[model samples]
Target: MADLTGSDLTAAKAQDDVAAPPSAPRRGGAAGLVRWDTAVGALLAVLLLCSFGFVGDFGNTLNLSFLIGNTLPMAVIALPMTMLVAAGEIDLSVGSVAGLSGAVMGSLWNAGMAIETIIPLCLLLGLVCGLVNGLLVTRLGLPSLAVTIGTMAAYRGIAQIVLGANSVTDFPQQYLDFGSGRIPGTFLPYAAIPWAVLAVIAVLVLHATGVGRSLFAVGASAEAAWFAGIRVKRLRLSMFAATGVVSALTGVFWVLHYASARYDNATGLELSVIAAVLLGGVDFDGGKGTLGGAIGGVFLLGTLENTMSLVDVSAQSQTVVTGVLLVVSVLGPRAGRQLARTVARRRSAGSGSAPAATG
Candidate 1:
């Protein structure tokens, strides 16, 4: 009888141990589902509802075209920005780079340069700027934040020097029309097509490709990535170059849409771009984000701006709202993590005590 009782107790204890592991996993899965459902899902639903309400014409095809057209420039740059942030870096010089590239294109055009010539030169200039940034940060072992901040000021200054308080408005009529034109008879803006395509490409690169996986690995831990044979420096340079090229492209798009390129175009836009990146769910510290989240973030910020404009909000007030939103978005994740840890601890304690009580 004694031996039987001992065997029964041992078997029950083993069963409980086995059950604990699976239960812990289930709880973890449940917590993740709850977090996603509560945070991302709820935020997205609210944005959709608000967008439709505010832009009543959102249901119309033309309205969709307009939204896409207006949003594409930001989207283009934001895609690469997402990648950069995922790798735990920031590029404050993007807006300045865009401004400078636009100025370069505009200046070349005004000098009677062919569109083909101007385009390639502008792209090259962007590439060079990116290269410099990568060299300064990686090769020189400087903090990216400091280096980019300096470059941001210098690049904008260069743009000003290139344009010298003048604006270029003599772009080819074809280019201007391309910027403003919609797809024939559909409200779909032609400008948006490129952006949409790029977004899809970006999604594929980040989610489907080995390079994307490498980027995540690098962002999660650069030393680990290097140890694993990833070319960390090369990847960083490539990312910087990609960012520059996209920013330049965005500059061209801006010039085309507005029919002019001023040295000051997109000034202070880096903040807006970064905000969109963070709002999209990229961690500031790196290693976690999605392009879809960034897209949603773009819509959120764009809609907020549009709404505020409609309500006659001051620029200062708008800035304040943005600042507040950024703070909340960033801090929200941390708070959630801490809460989850606390709950986990409590559950663990409860489970440990359950056997004691039964005994």
Candidate 2:
């Protein structure tokens, strides 16, 4: 084993790569998922109960439907985003990808194309957008954070060029209903059905299958995962593509839900998705987090925001709250990881000083 000196977990990881790499975060990996997951889940439940009891109009079927409907787009994109983040990467341009999808949808609609024809093309466009980001990161070895930031701007710019300032609101009524309308005699939105189905698939992929385990391995230690034959690059690339498709799908839903398609549709939504996901206890550092936690975070924030709105809290204040939550999520995981590393190190030192068993 290599003698490790660094106190920083990432620095230690960087230093101890070759000679018996230390599993720096194996014991409580993924940012102390069990603790944070349970914490966030309980918090969400409390928020819902309190909101129902205290907030007027929040428990009503109409408001509940609106809340779920509005949240589905962010939640949909979050499914793939969680996988991507857990695999040690992120696409900050998801909101932009969604915007581009909406822009393209509007442009094609203006060109008298069939809505059915336009939807597939929009999805394909998102795929291409994601592939471009993937290729840039995988092939060029660029950081995903930086790459997505650049692409976020570029994608939004292209969306603006494609749709300008125009708002397309003439989409078919049925599609709009599917986007925002509640199910008959229930509060569930029609769009939630697809999101639920996708959520189940994501849960299976992230928690139940080998690929899910691979995602954690890759995020935990890309080099180790690669050495262990995880096909790291391909897995990350596919996750990005999946994120793109979902973002595009969210864009379509955004347009339909709001009864408008503009270049700026879903603008700044990446912040909300990421905030909700991290708040749900998915470690921002990768290799740690649960899909269920991410979903809980989504609803918690969603319900909080909706309740705030019903009570006339300003949008600016809401944004501030979101920003603050994002900061907390990032910090909470880092603090837990630091503590975990310290405990693991002490345990290792203790074991090293222990007497060997006599044969």
Candidate 3:
């Protein structure tokens, strides 16, 4: 009887142990645990609904088409930028690299290079630009922010020098069509095809692969990732290069879509891209973002801009709106995290007081 009773007690303990789940890590507090992507997604949906419902002619196919097509370039750049931020770095020079690529293409075309040849050369130039940024940061141990900032000015200046107040029209019609054409019954442009493809690729790479996991690890702690055998420098370098290439491609699309190329093409584009990425809930500090969230961010801004344009909002006011949205994006998560910490501290104090009272 004694033995059976002991066995029963052991069994009960084992059952309780089995039933209890492990606690989740509270690294960044409640906000960290809360998926910002879902929130951003909901926000996007509401914004879209409001636009379609309230804005005059905003729901018309032609207007919708133009909105999507115009914004496609920014959307495309946001993909690699998402990964770049996920890995805990940024490339401010993307806009300038894009502008430079466009300038180079225009110059090459005028200098008797075929459009086909000019395209590849432009892509290569973009890759080189990326490599420079990556190498300078990784090798010289410079802060990416500063390095990219300097490069941004340098690249944009080069672009201005190359094209110098000149514009290029007369791109091939078929290519132009690819930029401006839309799918039947949809506002999505054919230029969005590459964006869609890259977005899928980015999703898989960021969320699925071992390499993707390494990016998170590196972003969280570079030293730890290095100890774990991840090549943090190589990964970052590759990402920078990828961003450069994609931005250059966006430049090409920009030229074709607008039927013109100028040195100022894609000016101030970097801000919009960064804003969308952060708004999607990708932490500026890095290692905690999703491609889906970033996409939601892109569409949310695009929708907001389109609606505002339809309402005849002033350009200055639109800029202010974007700035406000970016500030909110950064602050919202931080506020949540702070609240979580405060709650945790209060709970700890209460628990401590309860023990003393019992004593």
Superior candidate under lDDT, 1 versus 2: 2
**Candidate 1 local lDDT, 199-263, one digit each (tens):** 89999999899899988888999999999999988998899989988888888888998888999
lDDT digits (tens) for residues 3-122 of candidate 3: 765655565445434332222124346555657898899888888888888887998888988888877887999999988898889999999999999999899988888999999999
Q: Which ten residues in a row have the lowest lDDT in candidate 1?
A: 29-38
Which regions of candidate 2 fall more than 4 Å away from where they truly are?
A: 1-34, 339-359
Error of 2 at 48 (Å): 0.4
lDDT of 1: 0.80
TM-scores, each model vs. reference: 0.86, 0.87, 0.90
Which parts of model 1 are misplaced by more than 4 Å? 1-42, 54-64, 353-359
> What's the best-to-worst order under TM-score?
3, 2, 1
On the 0 to 100 scale, the lDDT of residue 141 in model 1 is 74
Best by TM-score: 3
How many residue pairs clash in each candidate at the backbone level?
A: 0, 1, 0
Candidate 3: pairs in clash = none
Question: What lDDT does candidate 2 reach at residue 174?
Answer: 88
